[model samples]
Target chain A: AQSVTQLDSQVPVFEEAPVELRCNYSSSVSVYLFWYVQYPNQGLQLLLKYLSGSTLVKGINGFEAEFNKSQTSFHLRKPSVHISDTAEYFCAVSPQGINSGYSTLTFGKGTMLLVSP
Target chain B: DAGITQSPRHKVTETGTPVTLRCHQTENHRYMYWYRQDPGHGLRLIHYSYGVKDTDKGEVSDGYSVSRSKTEDFLLTLESATSSQTSVYFCAISGRGIEQYFGPGTRLTVT
Candidate 1:
């Protein structure tokens, strides 16, 4: 019964500009959050994850996301983006503890980030 | 890719024909999963295996079957291919957490 919602279907940004991709989840219990990126004709790669401890988690490629427990949001942000950063990003969530024994991840629809010069 | 590979990277079959996709891994991970990606749907899990011969159905498992006979290989089969099944399929593996490494993906089409 867990679900993820990415508000933006597409985000267009110029090079060197800051960008944020919004993600929200609905889960009754504690959950693990993750962000993944997929370039053209390639598989998804992990950008970052929020397991515990830190509220602001930094990830690969100069990306960071903050896990706001009260708002049920984990939005990804970057100070600046490059043309190579153009890719489809996904937000995923999995419940904590024995309930997630299989470790199944529930993913949002995805947000396509189009970075241009 | 985490040493994961999917065979028949691009396949096209008829509606009534049977199709099977193979996923091979070299990392010897304990968990393997099969997911399908469609435009606007992101990725939906079809099946997963915790160990050899120990498989479980995922959220979108209808009309699909999976088999994991060995730790290194997982196979997904469609009894009858349909247009709705025309999408990219990805294989993922995880050792201990929810962090999964994905394969290059196989593009399947039913004409």
Candidate 2:
């Protein structure tokens, strides 16, 4: 079974400063990686995904993650953040390939990024 | 924005009562899923449907039951509402790939 671990439960950053939310996963087989963001009282939206291509993946709102196979980590980072970037971020892994018929993603406990002015 | 909607956007029920949450999608996607979100835990799958009349359990399915009688509707039922079950419920739809779309959640409060 695939599982995810988000190192920090909450990360507070000043506006215009850089931020990084750490995520690590454990899966026996090859897997797909994804980052999702959720606003207060809103559903989760896909930020970015890593299927098989470039290890450095860029996403909406400038969220980018690097897939380190050896480290089993996909950490989300942003050079600068705004007050509007305050939200909870999640990292997930889909261990089974697409041919499995349906997508089942194992999600990590979200890391709440608190952006302050 | 996957053309998915969940009924009873907010519901309050008493213990020992039965409650069913409805998830309807217009995309006619072959896969529909029900997940519950609580503080700290991002989201845990309760159940998922592959097709009409076909369903499977997920990581957290002990207290829930599901049914998919048609292609566009998936229902999740709680036989007896419990305090621990109070959380936000989200419905998601997917095709045959790693991309999945989510719907606005439904908040359920059990008293």
Candidate 3:
């Protein structure tokens, strides 16, 4: 079984400040990692995904995450954030392989990003 | 936006009553999923359909049933609505990939 853990339940930061949302996963096999964001009164939208290749994955809204296999972490980062970026971010993982058929995503509890002026 | 829409955007039903939520997509994606979002639980998959009449249970499939008679529509039903089932339900679509596009969501409250 695979699981995701978000270390922070909430992160508060001022506008234009750098921020990092920590995420760690437990999986024996190679997995695909993703970040999804949900604004107030809306559904989630994919922020970024790490399928293969580069360890540094850039996503929409100037957000990026690094996949560290040794640490089992895929933390989301932004050099600067805006008030509009205030949302709930989720980290999820799905096992990758031919044997893992019809695999579903396992998500962490979520981290609430609060951007203040 | 992947042209996904969930009907009955907001619904309130009493406990013990049957409730059904509809998800419709226009992108013709091969995969459709149903997920429920709670305050601290993030999102948990309830069911998914790979193709018409080909559905699978997800992590949290208890007390829930799903049907997909067409590629464009997937329906989720609660046999007997309960307070624990009150949450925001989202519909997502993917086309043979890991990335999924989500709909606006349906807010269902079982009172």
**What TM-score against the true fold does each predicted structure earn?**
0.97, 0.97, 0.97
- For candidate 3, the share of real interface contacts preserved is 0.53
In candidate 1 chain B, where is summed lDDT lowest over 10 consecutive residues?
B92-101
Relative to the true structure, candidate 1 has a C-alpha RMSD (angstroms) of: 1.2
> Over 4 Å off in model 2, which ranges?
A98-101
Q: Best to worst by DockQ, what's the order?
A: 2, 1, 3
Tens digits of lDDT, candidate 3, B3-106: 99999999999999999999999988888999999888888999999889999999899999999999999999999999999999998888767678899999
Candidate 2 local lDDT, B23-44, one digit each (tens): 9999889999999999988899
Worst 10 residues of 2 chain B by lDDT: B92-101
Mark the regions of model 3 whose C-alpha exceeds 4 Å error after superposition.
Answer: A99-103
lDDT of candidate 1 over A1-117, digit per residue (tens): 799999999999999999999999999899999999999999999999999998999999999999999999999999999999999999999888852335789999999999999
Give the CAPRI rating of model 1: medium
Q: Which residue pairs show collisions in model 2?
A: none
Q: Which candidate is the best by lDDT?
A: 1
Candidate 1 Cα misplacement greater than 4 A, ranges? A99-102
Q: Pick the candidate with the highest TM-score.
A: 1
